[model samples]
Target: MVGAKMSNNLPCGRFEMRISESLQPFIRNGLKGCEKEGLRISREGSISLSPHPVQLGAALTHPNITTDYSEALLELITPALSDGSEMLGFLTNLHRYVCTNIDDELLLSASMPIGDLRSSAIPIARYGSSNIGRMKHIYRQGLSYRYGGCMQVIAGIHFNYSLPESFWLEYQDFTKQPGDPQSFRASAYMGTIRNLQRYGWLIPYLFGSSPAVSKSFVDGRNSAYSNALEKFDETSYYKPFATSLRMSEIGYVNPVQASFRVSFNSLDEYIRDLSKATSIPYLDYERVGTKVGGKYRQLTTNLLQIENEYYTSVRPKQLTRPNERPLRALSNRGIQYIEIRSLDIDVFEPSGISIETTRFLEALSLLCLFHESPAHDIRQYDEVKHNALAVANKGRDPALKLLNKGQEVHLRTWALILCDQLQEICEALDNGNKARPYTQALHKQMEVIRHPELTSSAKMLATMRDQKLSVAELVLQKSREYTSHFQKTPLDNSVKRDFDLQVANSLEQLKRLNNASEIPFDEFLGNYFSKIPEPAKFPGIDRKASQVR
Candidate 1:
């Protein structure tokens, strides 16, 4: 067993290699267990100045499908799966299903939405008449009021992953950690999160696809690039060296969230801080008013309506019971998994994400788990946020610098260093004859670093330049092309049957919920909020029970 002192020094090249060699056997053993994953991808499209498709009723009622912020914005979710290929395949079939359903609308292929419409023209997503559905609908309305509906329409992919319990048990034994299996697993997951915060900037550097936006996206807002906006054609705006403008301040900036100091040290601290944010009222949001002209405009005047409202690059997550709050779920059971939220939808991929990208993310997650992660201070947190913004806006710039260990480092230089470490981790992950997809993915990223033009963002800009089309034009063209491709391709019979069943089941479930409610809507909301259980007196007990159930 490696001592704490020994593990602390394993962040460097030689030490990392030695540690990777030592952990290879355990890694292989862990891989033998079932590897599970969950994916949720969101995309926004226009409805030709008409109301959202009446055929696709209230987003709140759907299970596999839903809306993010705008009625036109569609979010497609895949149930958890162990295989990366299966996940992507399911997502593609979902695209096929949606393409067949919607009438006269194209999924916007770019991360940024078509910005030509008025804010009010973008309608908030509506759920049915049920109280829970109304809560979901009104929350989006609050989002539209707080952040412009246009910004909310910007779409991305979320990857939810959990290492099997067997892996953690083996890891605990290998590390000789002094705690129960549950506590060790929770600590490990938190460590992965902290490391991700430190290094996640590299993700956008390599995969960020939104380097430019239509001029209308920034028309009414006070933009830092307002002066630069005039240089492009009246139809488009861009940063010459940007990677993902979608992740920049222009996309989802919230000053109120910025002011709060949320800690990632432990589960208790996280739940406490997040809960406080939900309870504490903000003057700015209060001004928006919960009810306007007898119509509910927002959920509450709090900093956050719920835990899901707190936007970050990554989050610690736990599976919830039937109607359990996310915080309560986390409190009752420690962190079950973590969600990676920084990925932009790659325009070139019909699924919005590629198989290589997903494999690389899994590799990164493993790297975070295997490496040493020190507790971070608020200053470190702020630095990570700054680094993310810098990479999002100016990563491709030759002169860009990012902070590492309180010292300035060239972005490319730091990225290459991390890639080297990922290379080592990939070797550990690649068991003989099992395949080296992780290594292949890491190599691809290394090539992107070597050739800046190979990045998705750069390719997007180049295509626009070569084709002489605007951002909106290019995205719409691709969206149409992909729509045609999906429509022409037939789903596998088994896959088709499963999808049919899921849709049918989701509809039946919605009907059941609608009919089962016996209480008033307001009373339901009151009970829901009031019944949030306090942090469990015993942490590991409910977690084990949850696993059994």
Candidate 2:
């Protein structure tokens, strides 16, 4: 194991006054995992009309592979591992396996999918006739209705991480005020989630790569922010200093979700508010109707069909049991890890991400955990949202300002402060190694902040300008390159055999799920909602959702 030296001053403020040497190994070796999503486009760069490849196994039962909102939008997940390199290698292998199985289709490398897409054209994923399968499909149907299918096709990556038990145990001992180990761990993760949101705008400014998008993203409809985007050739639209259009108002932001009031202040508050949203009826969704024409239009008329529908940049996560709700799992096991959902897929990488990105994210997770995180109220929450959109829309603009503690601060100034603190954390993560991979990752990102033109968003726009290529053309070219890159590198026989076995097992699992005896759809929904009992409140946590966002 790499050795980390003790440091007196870590720029970690009061929270990390003295991080123990025992915790250093866990910080350096945090478990990292990734969930990458990409659109499966035809060779001509249009959305693929074909169903998910049968060769890859049933989308319903596949542990590592599944469909997102669309039948053609593939999501690949990697198991959490201590080494970032191993995590990335596993992700690469998953990509190779998918490419080998899917014939004549390419995974679009860019986050903002470019195609002649229409709401009717994109196929919603099907998971067979089981009750649970039907529930999944119907929930997606609700999404398509609430937020158009066009927006659902915008793909990105999710970074999942958790500090090791050693770190948590040492941390619990350090804090000394915690009740139980699980409660302390959950509280610590909640703090991390809050900090992650507080400074998440930096994510887009540094790594966002979706400044330009296809004209068809709006599908011939007049967009409210049509004036915000300038024409990039006849076939595309773009924002001059935009970082991630995928994160901007044009992408994932929506009116219904904008009004969502879930809390990151505490696990109990989060579960209570989220559970209430899932149960309380929303008038707008009510019009869609739970069952219309004898078919389920959605799972419910509630503000959220389920917890997953409430979108955020980050989420406290717990692994759920079979047929268990995500909230129930968290209430049962505390936060097992956190899922960082704001990263845009780097078009330059064959696996949609890189080892540097993973290492950097792991370090960031630790920084958030160790840093002081104050509880947030509604005003602070709105500020967070405003800053996120500002950075997403115009992060590269020289005059861009973001809200910091209700005051406007230049984006670069705030970034520098964060990076300086991050450098110390990364140094400790490097553990006196000569390679300094973590520090190197932080340095590369610092360069992007110093020279905005070096950002992925800027590079994407520059590439388009230099080549005089439309967004579709440039992304399609990269799609072809990535397809060949993955296909040409054959998976090892052992790995190939393992994937084949998984495929077979997934198919069998789906069959069993579909054939198993089950209750009626209405009864299933009732039972599901009924199971979300009010969790025992944490010792000092405020239960009011109004106190939070």
Candidate 3:
């Protein structure tokens, strides 16, 4: 127990390394403002439903979490989303909600528990227990089991929805204006500290050297990877939230996809919790787990099998042996997990996002968790990322080929097949009673591939070349839009000032952290792996260091 840590109440548990007493107000106000922003997404800035329906699965969420962005609609909003005195409650509630998202669930049936799925007490280090926040006493708690250096996970409502300029303008007129890069950091847990300089809606966050136990999972020394950015770049869940790197420099960085994966304590409890949180129905498992007694066994009642007959032997070598694609896996790990990512603040809108998007995400996650299997082994991750990069750079190119079963296939053809599968899955979801919006949303993407204008990469390139904008310049554009929206929201002077001040503080802190230097890479990862998750506290948790370079 000397080196180990657990939840707050545990004698050796770790609380957020920072003190909560100093800035409770900021957390609360931020949470309150987060409510009801969902309308800005799923329903707005979106196309009509697909007639045939499509199932996007975990590729995107079906639930409209954007509304959860608005203080008016979220359970955790009042305290954290506040534009006024509601600050302390705001931060606490905000943290609780995020944890709940990771822990709780709502089933498809009407019956569900009010409490979030009972969660195993997790680590309290939001950014990993560094004792950064100064106002309260920080405690060392229990650390994660498999993953080491578990940062308190940061989760947000990712809605696959958008709104029109007209709608955003109206909301801004009535809301507040405060898009100070600093203030948002009050609740945001990210490593890329420099990117804050650019208030652009789109950001490129870097990943630190992710020396994972699974070598198959990490991509080290990427031409795209940034070192200066790594100071602020978190390799795990904290990466996507913020960055110190300039997006102008790193052409395309995958949004941080950080998540704290937990194997359930009990199936009944897990089922009850997710059912309410998601407002979905759950049926009995057809079979559970891959081998006997595995965590996935709970899912036994419901099985989604991809028949074995489908095999591919023909394709161009380049497409077949994707330098970055995963080799297909034979074992069914059955351990189901989800990643929480893809959160973009809708700078133009009042809520920064909306509700419909959250629900859509919810729907999408269930579809994927219950449906898709990793096409291959963990070793295939490199290819996965490589394919992603190719798409980001040349998604619209018809000649592009991607690896498929040791064969090359037209990227367009692959996309269409994936898209077609989505439609089929959506039709089968809940026995086809209702279709998922993500199916239709795929069209939004197809439209972009057909015409480059809609892709983020395309938009980014166009803006940089045509407008001659630097990263900061583009960020400023987004900031103005968001600030204008916030300012219009009715609020008192004190609240606005406080919010602005918080933003300023965050920015200062971020810049300072980025500017600071560190030890060598070998030493940095050495100290990092020491904290790898173990069942019982490994004696190594007692080790300390100055900082990594």
Candidate 4:
């Protein structure tokens, strides 16, 4: 799918004009979904050491609510919906149901948790006795040993989306491409992923909510990052003009995979490289040992215990069947969706996201999909990483400069240009609707870009400084406020009943999985890694009927 190199400049007006009339309506039908993660905190505002509440259902089997890296980290997922408002409504109900179940515990309202945490203090999430469940638990254990548990506990929102097949068909024809529809669609999605890598920094700058943290977050770490952070107060650390510390090096960014290059040039290249990383052993992890003293310390001594361990701001996703490997699913099928992983869990919004944020992201996804994308090289890849860190650390700096096509450009200048391009996409997304919600969403983000203080990180800092509250204090208060709000407006009876039924069903499913499984863990692990599929081959779309209209 690698094509001729194109200039980084976006062909906004020309691209909009050239898109076929039939394709415009499909823009409004793109599917949107969200996965939001929040830490369960005690009433005193420290990370809760409690296990996942049983009333909410089994964390391993629940469809909507589950644990992420930590037993206390609640990850709530929403089903894909065409309407952003509906998707958010589902997410809201999930939160309300969860709040009703967990007695007295507040959902932490910030991306970065507040408190002093040693790696030993963070609890690894547990699954039951099933082989699959055990694999999940051991994988997290691997993460703790490899990256330390502190990094694993930080939470954020993942926006998942896919354009309608009608849109893809029109887009493929519009581009005069000749390939299998599935192949072309996956290739197009890869192009979008590549563009996302190039421009994804914008998300953190606009929506980033974590700029400061409890000093205890990095209490004893002796690294360059310690010097980078300024003391906000006796209890906190912050960067004066930072956007999202969560997206920065101190967050989920992994230094171990720095030398590993996973290509986005093509689906085959991406699969090949990622698969190789899983097989190649890293000396540091080998020293940690996969199994030590009759206990599994980690999954493999490989650079990546699994593909999920390779943290990135964006990922191409395919739906996986039960017991199927994610890589195998992608190889057998094709790209199903793209996950936007840079979004911070918004502190002010009870749902950790807003309709405005959702609409803006949808428009941004469209822009990435429609834009002409060139394949990435090592130099471009480095620039993307450098730009991401710059925005994460100092995005609100008026003089912040980012590398665009190897030339330095002011952050504000680049942002304005990107917003201008997004305007057309937003308009198309708002077609057939008089409200123009998508356009409004884009305009709101533009205002944030113009007024740096309007960014979430700035607002959070302002609140902290004005009141002289510690990071923990501010978030704890917000958590209490939001939890109260949700409690006041409980879920509708039908919704409540549905959630309750799901909880019962999930527990039953987990029990069955635990009791029915008989395979030895060693054989299960062997079968899993050995099933990694070879690179796929796809035929071109029949060219006889294809014509450039």
lDDT of 1 at 182: 74
Tens-digit lDDT track of model 3 for 406-502 = 4556665544443343343333322333544444454554564455444433454345448865332343454344433333343446744554454
Ranking of predictions according to TM-score: 4, 2, 1, 3
State each model's CA lDDT, in order: 0.72, 0.84, 0.25, 0.84
List the pairs of residues colliding in candidate 2.
none
lDDT of 2: 0.84
Q: Which candidate is the best by TM-score?
A: 4
Question: Alpha carbon lDDT of residue 215, candidate 3?
Answer: 12
The C-alpha stretches of model 3 lying farther than 4 A from their native spots are: 1-337, 342-367, 370-379, 392-398, 424-440, 464-468, 491-549
lDDT of 2 by residue, 58-145 (tens): 9999989999999999999999999889889999999999998889899999998777678788899999989889989999998888
lDDT by residue for model 4 (308-412), tens: 888888888998898887888888899999999999989889999999999998888877777778889978899999999999999999989998777888888
lDDT at position 194, candidate 3:
11
Q: In candidate 2, which residue ranges exceed 4 Å CA deviation?
A: 1-18, 220-222, 533-549
- What C-alpha RMSD separates each model from the true structure? 6.9, 4.5, 24.5, 7.3
